[model samples]
Target: MTDDTGYEFFEHTADVGMRASGGSLAELFAHAARGLVALVAEDSAIRPAETRAVRLRAASVEALLRAWLSELLMWFDTDRFLPAEYALGAVSATALEGEVRGERFDPARHTYGTEVKGVTRHQFRVEQRDGGWTANVIFDV
Candidate 1:
């Protein structure tokens, strides 16, 4: 789905794809994370009442993106955590450190969306072009 935000979802064969673009790497990552959250739960229903610290390392930017999204997915899978805000302290080609602020899922108060089983590497990419960063990720439902 296309929106005013820097992120949009595309139709995949049996999955969902997300494309996010931003002026910087950190902004791009944040937009990608937001897209993932949107897929798992309604963003408007989440609250920034809790904070979770995140630190990840990978061999490349593509791998880092996968790890970042996977960590977020893990949180959702384990505790039904839905992130509302992302405060990235640092983002590099191989590492990322940040804090995600959000609350756990409460059926009475939150609206659940699709159940994202995992982040897929198929057609996954993170690239910088024309002074901007763009990321394309597909989630398996």
Candidate 2:
């Protein structure tokens, strides 16, 4: 379970499940975003050719994280954006904002993995334990 990457993937029947942990909630969310990118494109294949701002407000931390990741997925589904890097500007229980750096999807360069349709509400969780924060998310791939 300790890949030293701060994130890991777990088996699921239909969708994919991911767990990301860090010393802080912000880092946990950042790693979760990275986990999503790792599932889509190879880390080295994606370049920071463009930047986009992400902002979301939810009722709780778990909801906020889901919305943030779902918003990124929307870019890929709608505009073919593939984000490989993220800079978290702000992350809180009720709101989140960040800057994502990546380029338009290029099949020739980027290696696509599971195509995540959406973030699921089932089996989703966010909590703090052992001096760290953890976020468990499932994607409708």
The C-alpha lDDT values of all candidates are 0.87, 0.84
Tens digits of lDDT, candidate 1, 71-134 = 9999989998889888997998999998999998998888778999888999998888988889
Cα lDDT for residue 101, model 2? 90
lDDT of 2 by residue, 1-141 (tens): 435788999999878999899887778887888888888775647788899988889999988889888888889889889887778878878888788898898888878677888899988999888998888888887
Best by lDDT: 1
Model 1 CA lDDT for position 70: 93
| Location of the lowest summed lDDT over 10 successive residues in candidate 1 | 1-10
User: TM-score for model 1?
Assistant: 0.94
Best by TM-score: 1
